[model samples]
Target: MNKISESGVIGVDVHTIKSWIDQDDVVLVDVRETSEYDKEHIPGAMLLPMSKFDAEIFPKVLGKKVVLHCAVGKRSESAGKMLIDEGYLETVHMIGGIEAWKASGFATEVQITPPPSPSELKNQEPQFLCPTPGEVLRDEYMTPLSISNAELAGCIGVTEKDIEQLTQGESKVDVVLSLRLARYFSTAADFWVHLQIERDLEEARHEIGHTIREEISPRATASN
Candidate 1:
């Protein structure tokens, strides 16, 4: 309905977003948490929880505008800016979010699911970006199953000290460990590897993000 800035992201009414959705000209991303999303959400909006949002991981919205919306618009505005910062030429955020849409008599899809126990939620909830893979392993995977490092080591054919060191962040997740954990946890080995890589890259970014531009230059190609 109104332009908020010079950048591509702009505020639009629920009807405008609905029209874009109807025309299939926009990729709608709901930036609300999973709990809220599971209860009810815009019929076609893909859930990308703000708590775990990674701009780099925003879905492929090729040839279509990316529209973000939340419960009431604030999260969508922030998410829109995230797309802008990630070099999106233009982005749109629904001004009133699903709340406004519902107020306007728009239909929403609801997912039926059982609520998780509080302890389950505590164990499953991740620290945004999850500071370390070890923390993730200890808090999420291990504690939830009541598996001590010694037990996990025994089950996975690794030494107790190895598991201890890994959970302590004193060691890293290697191919062997990844495979072992994957087998024991019924997960992909790549999952552990990716977690380690994400942690390493996040630390690197924090350590040198600001200096990257000044320190590196694009290689020149030979003039034709």
Candidate 2:
């Protein structure tokens, strides 16, 4: 099968992707909406919907190549750009997505299982990086439930801007918001607060360690 290229994105045929799948040498990602992904997708593909695609939060391919796709090729192309922009050296988008794959006599996987119960979610660590509370809210809850900003605000009794700001990371997750999110998403309020605390600590460590290390260096004392 022939490979196509456009706008810095590499498009490979379904057959080529299938070869990688058989070899298990590539990380396949589905970049469609949650509802669409819950309908059907390529087997072994992890769902990372485009609406909440955070390059920093995305799982790395490690030693393998990364392949992305949606219902068609367009969204995957965009996802490819995001990955490339974020320093992914080897990335490919499935040309024509599952549609072309099925048309070419390849099989697709249908999602028949419901989401795990809250008890099941307990004790499981997040699969991606330490994401912000807003990112978790957007991807895990709001997107999955198809809740619009206005709808969520109405249900939770907050302004739409409040919800928007939280999701955009422009505002911090406070006790009230945490309570609302916890109630709506079936998670603990501390889950939301701890996500913010962890992110803050990570940032502080990066900057604080550099400054303190330079000031306290043994070489500085020796020179003095």
Candidate 3:
């Protein structure tokens, strides 16, 4: 009874076609001008231009559904009708064609999108400027207490260069320095060490935060 169906040519939407590409065994046949295809086309599509379209020799993958499409629906419908006329079991063509596919925000083989400029890239790439421990030292303790680099170095039992680099954000505060700073400031050692950890995390985030988010996801969130 299904073989006696009303129409052999089935019209499919771009979203459905896209799902077929992603989830099913399907072959996309593009019937368009060479110039048009050279500009932009669906990835992995077989080009069989309508200018020289021959339905008799139309490719049919053994276990795959052949989906025909053109720039607009007209030529593809005509092409599909040709296949039906050629004693084909069934024919499928994308309704609204590549025009609908582009309208639906699907990526094509050729990209006409302009690249961002240097200034635009700079604006797009985020800068995370969390307070470095050097900034904390200079702003919170050193400036308020009027502790000179030499004075702090002598008191903390560190070289003047070490204190200078630490205050200038070029060096990191480790356990020894954190303990010394904590004892001198009468604060918990965790305070300085935590600041260093926070600074390290901020730096790491600035460098590869986006890549990490793209590559790794929580298992629950990934399933969703």
Best by TM-score: 2
lDDT of 2: 0.74
Specify the poorest-scoring 10-residue window by lDDT in model 1: 124-133
How do these models rank on TM-score, best leading? Answer: 2, 1, 3
Candidate 3 segments exceeding 4 Å error: 1-8, 111-224
* lDDT for each residue of candidate 3 in 1-224, tens digit (9 for 90 to 100): 01111235677888888988997679999877576687789999989876667767876679888988876554566567677878775788887678789899997888476888998997896433234667667755677568999999999899889989998889998888988987786544554676677668877888899899999987765453
TM-scores, one per candidate: 0.48, 0.49, 0.46
Reference-based lDDT, residue 168, model 2: 98
Residue lDDT tens for model 2, 45-147: 8998877787666786577878898765655765676667778756688887777888899888776778878988885543322356787678756785688
Q: How many angstroms is residue 49 displaced in model 3 relative to the true structure, after the best TM-score fit?
A: 0.3
Write out the backbone clash pairs for model 3: none
User: Lowest summed-lDDT stretch of 10 residues in model 3?
Assistant: 1-10
Q: Give the TM-score of candidate 3.
A: 0.46
